[model samples]
Target: MESTSLQPASAPAGKFLSRFLIITVTICILISPGYIFFSERGGIGFIEGVTVKQLLHLIFPFFGLYAFTLVWGQIIIGTCKPLIKKIFPGIGRFHRLEGIFAFIFALIHPVLLIGSLGAVTYLKYEFVGPNKKIFVLLGVTALLLLIVTVTTALLMRLPWLQKRWKKLHYANYAVFILVFIHSWNLGTDIQGSPLQYLWMFFAVSAGLGTLYRIWRAIVKRRTAMSAQSATASEPTNSLNPPNS
Candidate 1:
């Protein structure tokens, strides 16, 4: 019998675009509940004659765009083997691509959002807004974090700074926290709906929960190894039968 041949997969030009669309569709689908709930009576939607909500809703897509970079960033960085490995030597290429996405979101988030907050608020508070100052702080912090993250990403593009780049990229942990705060607790969105708050709370908790799960696994593995080591050494002690 002839062996079944494995098919070779070639990378296509539109592959990234397809993957992006798929992820965008998935997130929009997942967040539909929040969108519907916000639309009916929950979010800024209920206000009569208020055009601000409409404009703000238009700006919302950037949130999804920024969020996409975040989830993808975690995947690219977390799943890869340690940076020292030569097989995947093009770390700089991936890093640059991530930076380009990040900066695109960074630029778009503000430009699209600036009009939504209206004339007075936009002028007074700037990129994020006035009433949502805390959220703005979080957003700015996330921006700064992205700046560092992107800086390291670009730094990885160069051999001169490659050694220190990984260390700087570790700042992404802090960046993730700022991003979660900005995303979860941003402005009146959370204040208006208890269910919305609950959703955000759980989403943030899920990130922490994932980290906790990883930590627990590491601890358990270490404990088991320690126990095995002790057991292995015990036999040698018994055979030697050393005087106390």
Candidate 2:
């Protein structure tokens, strides 16, 4: 009776905790732009000095970072299933939702910049300046790769594409690397700010997550090989009965 009563109570508690986590993460993503704006610009006073175009341009970085955070979370969650199961129990259900939001924000990041810069200037692509060209290129490349990756993910349900889609999804690792380089070099808010430390932490976490994934893959492959070998040997042993 005690065990039965505790089981029901625990289920509600777990559900409540998952809901709280989802709410907390959503609030953080929504408010991060405001936080970045205030922290870098010294509050609302700076907003008065900027034009709408400038404000939109300023918002690009916030959107980029938002997308990056979502991608990073996806990586961590994908690689660390056990950790997610223990902590963020139900978050796997929201994985696709997170991807959709990340892709939207990433698309907006460049669109806002292009809108602020004007189509012709953005077309020229020289506005980033010579010194910053490489970093800007990295960001552009990351965005392009993100588009491809997300498109493939959306199409993954197709019968013919199901197996191939996973291979294309690996492109996200390249996207992560490119975006990290782009932001570390070009992000104004990241440089000389506490946010830099946070960014670094995420990068480190991603690296560790990637390593864990590789290790898991190796182990899985070896386990499969060992099982196959054992299965093969079993047939031989059966054909020529043991001494016992």
Candidate 3:
């Protein structure tokens, strides 16, 4: 009999190229922030007259970009199951790690912003003032939702919460939307640079992923309902035949 274990199976032979590509891509993502930082700082010539506070401020955008990438990746993985299974069969192992790192990078981005802007200024929110910072408020709301989602995900280990956590985790979709709007309006690094194209790409891809997920769910539900109706209409087997 074939084994029915829920554990992910090992990658098949000839999948080495896929594994190599994934690792190479991950390495590039990990180092991209440093490359962008130096390139933005006048090609390594920005050390002169640059203060420690200025450095922290400069680093915040890159961190936010990294976090956004990770979140976008999660959406792609969740929505494109077949593609991910084909490309990197072992990716399931690192799914939670990806989320954790995304959260860490996300948390750091705002902290660094606060470091430069001061907590009082960073926390200020005015919807109808000349000094209104609605974009900042949106970013703050996204971060708070992310915190709640991640907390519930971690608590899912408890028997009582295992079935209930997914409802809270769905808040991540809202988080992504809020973050996209927030960054589009307020992100300095992506506003007028080539990075804006990259940001747009992530947003479009995530939007498509969400649509695909919704379509798949609808199809699955329809298939299940059709099968159930067919089963209900089948004639029942009886020990004695009925008179015609």
Candidate 2 stretches with Cα past 4 Å from truth are 1-34, 86-90, 241-244
* Clashing pairs for predicted structure model 2, backbone only: none
Regarding TM-score, does 2 or 3 come out ahead? 2
Candidate No. with top lDDT: 2
Task: Give the best candidate by TM-score.
Answer: 2
lDDT of 2 by residue, 1-244 (tens): 8888799889879878976896797677557645875778787676577888988886777788787877887777777866667666676666767777878988898899998999888877767787888888888898898888888878889998898988988888888888888888888878887777767877898899999989989999999999999998997888895688
lDDT of 1 by residue, 55-97 (tens): 6655564353345344445533443324212333555565467
Q: Assess candidate 3 and give its TM-score to the true structure.
A: 0.80
Better of 1 and 2 by lDDT: 2
Q: Model 3 clash pairs?
A: none
Q: lDDT of all predictions, in order shown?
A: 0.58, 0.81, 0.76
Question: TM-scores of all models?
Answer: 0.50, 0.84, 0.80
